[model samples]
Target: MYLKSIALVGFKSFGRKTELAFGSPIVAVVGPNGSGKSNVAEAFRFVLGEQSMKSMRSKRGEDLIWGGSPGLPRANRGAVRVVFDNADRLLDLDFKEVVIERVVYRDGQNEYLLNGTVVRLKDVIRLLAGANIGGSGYQIISQGEADRILNASPKERREMVEDALGLKLYQHKKAESERKLGETGVNIDKTKSLRRELAPHINFLRVQVEKIEKARELKEQLAAKLNEYLAREHAWISQEDARLSEEIRMHETELRKLSESVRAARGARGSSSDAALAGLQGKLAEREGKLAAARRESERLARELGRAEGALEANNVTVEAIVPVPHVRNFARELDATVSELERVDDIARVRSVLQDIRSRIKSFIEGLSGAAPVTNEEVKQQVKSLADSLARVREEETNLADELESLRKGIAEARESGFAAERDLVALEASVREAQSKLGGVRAARENIAEARRRFEEEVREGIALVGAAVHSWEKAEIPPGALSEERSVQEKRRRDIERLKIKIEESGSGSGEAVVKEFTQTKERDEFLAKELADLEASAASLKDIIAELEKTIDARFHEGLKLINEALKNFFTKLFGGGYVDIRFVASQEDTRIGGSLGRGARAYLYRTHFFDDAGESSALPRSRRDRRRAR
Candidate 1:
């Protein structure tokens, strides 16, 4: 590769765009001082990816931009581009010509471009290193820095010689490999530390997962036991329920039949007799009331008749006019008939009307007596006769009422006797009914006990389902063992106890978090495995980097020593030719102190060159030769 052209824009004194074309192998810029000759050389460094501002004769990036003159404006940025003729492909690019550019802004930001495409400073450095070119190398010697190689320390001079010999690429690769190896070592330590930290948690999760798995097993056992227990219990309860229902139905039917028998017995006995006797007793009471009223009327009529007789006997004076005897007899007969009708009339209204008619007739007869002329003795006799006949008729009615009352008393006595017998039979029938009701109540109470048992059984089923999940419903298809009904309840109780024990164990094991614990365990274990794999990969990469670093170091050392020998041979010839018959020699001397390489302690040596010149048997004097003591004293 060779220099083609360089372009500068807003760079230092080149405020406007500037281009320099180098068509020959050697080119020189002859300018007076302060005419940008140094700036042009610095632009080459800038475009080649120099990082230090002080090396470019500037304090900061903005100082590298052109400061305005009186007639020109200041630049906001500085850019430099170098084009290389790469027809020989020495630059590691496919193109015949390669352009590399760098731009620095006033804010101290920098941009790099390769062939018009943006790139990083590291990319530019790497690409340039392949062609044995670098920003700070012996290839671009400044005007006053011609003797820098002779004045530089052994290490710095070694680096400059290495750059000139085109070993900078190997040096860069070795340095990068060492840096990556250090980072890989740090990453390995971190990965191991992480694994150490994760160890206890992973173990804890393993224990939890084991516990959950055991709980799952116990739950499975509990579920199976529940299926059998629930199914058997349900079967027994159903059987009991049906049996109790049938017994209840039988008891109810018996109770109903007993009740009907009691009713039939009551009907077959003196149920109507009791009603007839009650009616006859009521009529007897009415007849007794009528007898008392008739006796009173009879007494009243006897008094009235005696009063009429006494009036006739005392007066002895006859009325001139007399009522006809037949009429008087007819009145007496009518009064008697009214009293009889009163006795026959059951209604009070009819009896009252009859009594009122008798009173009106008596009143009219007395009024006629007062109005009669003296017919006298005959009319008094007839009135006396009529009053006596009325008394007699009333007395007859009282006697008839007494006779009817006696018959009603006899009928009532017979009805009472019959009612006693019927009541005894009713009491016996009621006792039987009561006995049947007592039996029915006992059966109903037993049925209630069965119902309560069924309720309790259902409650147990619900509890089982809650504990073991809805899978308990699978119990419906479970078979009850033959003759399980004959098994003692204690057997079921034992089964229940077993179920409860399993449930307690399952709860203690925390089955509820089984799935989550398993998932977390799996994930944690996977993370640990992945980390382990990554750690192994990092260690392998670190090992590979170390190997590469060791190889590169070997190559660099070999090449450096070879280049030093060539340079010494050329220097010897040049010294002989330039000074005519004086001899100069350059050779390597190893340093003593240990050096750190790739974050490790190791032996390190740099070639320290000293020049010795001799003239005709005089001992040689060393130029720039220092022992360890002198070197230390210089430090």
Candidate 2:
């Protein structure tokens, strides 16, 4: 797949959203210095999951975003997106086109999206790898990058060539395999250590297993005895169940007979009592009516006799003439006339209530004199008080006038009462009402007595009826209800006990005796013994296998170095041709594993040469080329 277009927003010098389109094979991005030419390369790196901020020439994530310049305001985010045309199925995707976008926020958080769906950076790397456009490969080249191939150390140069030749994937696989192999080695060591620790125990288990076998035989004998005992217990339980059922039947028969007898007794009592109470209530009511009539007759005769006696006593008494109480005007009328004529004195001051205020002020003036200053007597405060009291009194006078007007209205009504016949009729009617009141009081007393008697009669009847009904109901309930069959409780108890005993026997067979311990020992010992045999067989098999793997890895590693050397040679030649004239060569650095500490092994050698031409100038004296010891000797 080839890149089709790229978009940059707030990334480096591309402050605004910028889009660049590319054609089939190659697209050259050319611009003057600081015109965002390199920014295009950085954009590619950014979208392709390059995470090295240092390599991108940025100190912090925020540096990638646009900060406000003189003409432009700062943007909150930086983003780079690259679109690819995958019509040739160069990438591991079914789509004809793919878009990869990355955005960096000022807050140091980042996001990546693949085809508008958010994904991880690793996904982008893997996708590029599938397209044969991996990191540090020949697909992308910079100005210095082309020359670096020949200048790089043999190991680094080899890695570069391997990347181009598609060996990088294999190397990655090998590294991953080595990592897993290391972990497996650790696990194997731990397993071996465990086996060593268990060796003594394994021997002990073997002895235990032998004892277990014998114990198991003994357990079989015990289980047989237990089975025989259970059979005997079962027979005993069956016989006892029959006996218990027979006894339960007898008790149930007795209980049933007793219940019937109790029911009959209760029914007889209820019938006899209700009849007697009914008859007695009718007789009592009749007697009560007769007594009430007798009492009434007695009261009537007594009232008549009292009237007769009063007349006789009146006739016997001599009456002196009490001169007709001369139409004495009642004191009420006298009081009214006196109040009306007693003082036609102008009550303006009294009505004004100012007289009370004047008296109050005179009293205060005297009191203030006792504490007065000679120059300005404290009477000023007292005078203020007097004025306030006068104002209040004047208000009171107005209130009193209003009250007098109301009193005048009442007096007018009273004066009119003297000629009101309806009022006189009402008073006469009231006197008759007093007489009726006395009769009503007597009638109320009679009603109260009747009510109390009726209450007592109802209470007695209700209680008697309830008591009799409760007794009857209780007796019926106590009678034996049908379908209630007693259980053979003893038989059930025996069966439960047998079950419990059988369970206990099973547990005893499993754990209580040496048989169980022996069985455990046998199983454990057998397992370990088998493991030991298997381990021996595995060790033997692995011995040859380990040697083969070691030899194979060594061969592969050697061949890898060889192929790497060949590629470096080719890369150097390609670079020399591409540059036209550049004396460039790669040097090899041996691994630490091949180097001796005392420098027994010589310094690494150079193999690849990228030389367009080599010319020696006679006029220029060549620097002395000698070993360090020879140079020191000459000095």
Candidate 3:
């Protein structure tokens, strides 16, 4: 059988239903990472009964389920089902096709089904094994498993090749045969033990047969007594059951009447309930109206208070901005001094220029005296005098300029301080006005909030009033009241209790005073029946076991004879190949039990060897190795 198709539902990453079909001889699966292609291979393994979760790349069985992604909801369980085409009669039974399914739940539980009927994992494994198919079998080789044959030891490799040769059927049969042989041995031992145990009982029964015959008569007498007693008790129970049944009937009738009365009473009280509900509605409306009026009054008072505060804050700003006259006068004097100082600093530059010009003319006159010569004393002295006068005047002028520049700087510094203070006072006045305006805006907002709250309350009060009036009108039409229902329910409960008491009386009367005796008798009868059934089953098992033992003995004898026949034929072929001869030898040994005069069961072939000679190129006569006695003596 070959796999035809597999269907997956919520198994691994195949979140939705998916199906894969296989071609006759080859089916290739190719995919990128996480496309669930490997999961498809694993699905085959799962349905084939692979019990190792680790081999499947999962730490727990529930890991096989598809935990949904962000776009799809999670599934609670997973399923993988495989279909097989069995038309070639590869499987043990003849069927066109087979479908097997395996399901796993998040709770780490698994279920297996065959053709929609639940079955065990053992059944699935056996079915696949019959077809020479399994998780790691030759028919399905995964990419990584190719090296398994290379890595296997000699014995394991032999086993693998044997399985590929379709020897699994023979191996399974051999194992099953061995298991049956072992079980039969165990059963033989058990049966022998049972026979030993029954020996004393069998002997005892043989001795007690005569007494048992006498006891049978007494048993019949006891049975008659039991029947007589049971009949008397049955009559008393029947009479009691009848009386209780009649009382139960009377109670049932009364209960029905009381139930009808309750329905009528509840209908009559409907009008009163409606009226009471209407009054409550009216009261609720009145409270709502008072609440609305209070809110409106509070809002009006809030608005008036806000207006008054705004007017007061606005007037306060004007009074704070009035300045003192002395401050203004100080500012005017500082500005005047600054302008005068600016004029004095402008004249010192001209004086310094006249001094520099006088000095330069003196130096030019001295240098013009003569080409190679040192100056005469009188000329040198005259030049020195002119220079001294120019230098002395420049120094005096610079001293005067320095004193004037110092005074000007002092005046400018004082003016700057006064200007900064004036700027500060202006800024403070502007800030106070802004602060007052902010407070006025906030007060107005608060008043508006209160007015809105009052309006909402008024609307609710009007709606509540209308709701109460409508409810009152509805109540008048309803025709229902409350208390009558409670009274009628009490009467109904009494009738029900009466019915229950009558049922108890009927049941007790049937059971009667002889209940203890009857219970004991029934228990005894059940015990006897169980003992008899067990005895019958044990006798059947013992008989079947004898038949099985005889059959096994005959089969083993026949198989041993057949094995010797095959061994002889194989020996004949092997010898002819080794010896290059026309004649061959074959033999069968007598069974060990038949050779009771046992010397050491000697080592030699049972078949006597004989040789036939053939001619060489010249046709000469030749002698051949033959005769056990001649060969042994020569060695």
lDDT of each: 0.79, 0.53, 0.50
Candidate number achieving the greatest TM-score relative to the actual structure: 1
lDDT: which candidate is best? 1
Taking every candidate in turn, the Cα RMSD to the unseen true structure, in Å, is 16.1, 44.4, 54.0
Cα RMSD, model 3: 54.0
Worst 10 residues of 2 by lDDT: 319-328
* Candidate 1 lDDT over residue span 358-400, tens digit each: 7678878878776754444666676677677767877887898
Tens-place lDDT digits, model 2, residues 1-635: 67789999999887888999987576677878889887788778778887889757798899999887888899899999989999998777889999999999999899999899999776777677655565663555666886666455444555555566555444444444445445555655665776777777767755665545444444454344333333333334344445445544554554455455445544544565445545545444443443333334234334433543353244442211211111112222332332233123234333223333333433443343234322121223223333333334334433544455455445444434432443454455455455445444545554455456446434533432332222222222232324222344465356445544544444544433355556666676666666666666556545544454455445545666687567557756775687564433333434444322222222342233221222233322222212354357647
TM per candidate: 0.64, 0.38, 0.33
Greater lDDT among 1 and 3 belongs to 1
lDDT of 3: 0.50
Give the backbone clash total of model 1. Answer: 10
> What's the residue-level lDDT of 403 in candidate 3?
49
**Best to worst by TM-score, what's the order?**
1, 2, 3
TM-score for candidate 3:
0.33
> What is candidate 3's lDDT per residue for 144-173, written digit by digit as tens?
777765454333443454455444444444
Residue 225 displacement (Å), model 1: 3.9
